[model samples]
Target: MARLELENLTKHYGGQATVRGVTLDIPDGEFLVLLGPSGCGKTTTLRMIAGFIEPSGGSVRLGGQDITHRPPWRRNTGMVFQSYALFPHMTVAQNVAFGLEMRKIGRAEREARALEALRMVRLDGLADRLPRQMSGGQQQRVALARALAIRPDVLLLDEPLSNLDAKLREEVRIEIRQLQQQLGLTAIMVTHDQEEALTVADRLVVMAEGEIRQIGSQQDLYERPADRFVAGFVGRSTVITGQVREPGLFESAGGLRLRCQGATAPGAASLVLRPEAIHLDPPPDEHNRLEGEVTFASYLGPVLELHLRLSAEDRITVHLPNRGGAGLIRAGDRVSIGWPQDTGIVFAGTA
Candidate 1:
């Protein structure tokens, strides 16, 4: 295992910047995830770390050694691509041993290491099978085992679960997380899926437009976002553009007055409300309340997602537990929703 560091890492294409001054420290044995939408530079950053793409400026360090200009083969890093990237003609064992062969290891020791790596991913029984004969999930494991066979100092995954079906993706992700932990591997993954990042990462870095937005744990990003962008991206939220008249008073753009809690100075600001924090038919003592008609209701097993329109321009989303019969709500139904004053997160600026 190794600690990885990127200092003022930057990349430019022509005159446009792809990654701008990204600096981070990932301790040994940590599972760090880079999360953002498409064209957000997450993959570019990962490729830089893997030495597949050279940066325009800055440096990459592994275990305190500078490797900014090292070739991919000499970096001692394992990479699992989005597509399994397996050789169709090679059997599982041969594929896993390819890295060892590249390093000029003897045949007998290469075979032993290949077998052990396959065993780690629970694919030893299928060593002789070609990737064509295995399912997508199994093929993914083969790729993982191949990377592990070389005993790399760091593991890098680039949207490694994007090709699998929903159920299989969940299963394979759990297995990957478990295997990484068991080996104490330092891993970095780049992905756009919020749930996947939340599931496997010790810390998450959210980026946009070649710049980082926030770096925090799953709980911190969800409960206390640094800005409206983080709040809207890390999870579901209802963002209201409004102005703070005072410390605890706010007025919405649609002419609705509300009592809210925040230390934001009186100015143009926004209120972020989590779907799960709002309540239906709230008690009279609740500090924040709204009357709206249900615009839509979606039943999603354990919870129901509701879209409520308080006015022509002001709408909000709420999630309620799906208890049977009377608790069920539908579209076009009038309802009163409220939450505690402290439940809303207030941030300066309307955008």
Candidate 2:
């Protein structure tokens, strides 16, 4: 395993910056995920680390050695591409051994390492099968084995599970996380899927446009988002734009008063309420209560997602557990919702 560092790493195309001054330190054996929406520089940053794209400025260090100018072949990094990038004609074992062969390892050692890597991913039995003969999940494991066969200092996964079906994606992500932890590999994955990042990463770096928004564990980001964008992106949140009227009060744009916590300096702010934090038919003594007309309801197995309109300009989403009687609330129904003051996170911004 190796510790990786990016120092003021930047990328530009035609004078337009795509990645801006991203400096991060990834400790040894840490599974760090770069998470953001499309075109947000997460993939570019991963490619830069893999030496597939030359940075416009800054440096990349691996295991305390400067490798900013090193070619991809010389960086000792293994990359699993989004497409699985397997050779159609080559058998699984051949594909996995390709990297070892490229490095001129002897034939016997390459074969041994290929089988070992395949075994690691539980695909050794199908080593002789062609890529086209296997399932998508199997092909993905072949790609993973190929990367691991190289015995790289760092493993880079670029949207590794985006091609699988929902069930397989979840299964493969669990496998990947288990393999990563078992091997203690210093891995960095670039993904737009928040759930995948939450499942696999030890720490997450949330990026936007060309810079980082926040970096934290799954619980930290979900429970205490740094801003409106993160609160909405990382999880489900009902964001209310308004101004702080006092230390414990917020007035929404629609003129609804709410009891909140976490912001003191009363300027323009946004109240971020997690959907799960709100409860239906709160008691009379509840600190924060609101009555809204249910606009829509979605039954999602264990939970019912409700969209409610508080007024012409204000709406909030609430998630109620799908316990025995949750189906009673439906569209057009007037519902009373309430949450504790501290349940709402108030950030000092409107945009």
Q: Which candidate leads in lDDT? A: 2
- Tens-place lDDT per residue, model 2, 1-351, is 799999999999998999999999999999999999999999999999999899999999999999999999898998999999999989999999999999999999999999999999999999999999999999999999999989889999999999999999999999989998999999999999999999999999999998999999999899988777888899888889999988989999999999887778889998999999999989999999889999999999899999999988899999998887658888999989999998999988778
> Compared with the true structure, what per-residue lDDT tens digits does model 1 show for residues 135-204?
9999999999999889888999999999999999999899889999999999999999999999999999
> All models: lDDT?
0.92, 0.93
RMSD of 1: 1.1
Question: In candidate 1, which residue pairs clash?
Answer: none
- Model 1 — which ten-residue stretch has the worst lDDT? 321-330
Q: Estimated TM-score per prediction?
A: 0.98, 0.97
- C-alpha positional error of residue 53 in candidate 2 after TM-score superposition, expressed in Å: 0.7
With a 3 Å backbone cut-off (N, CA, C), the pairs that clash in candidate 2 are none
| Candidate 2 similarity to native, TM-score | 0.97
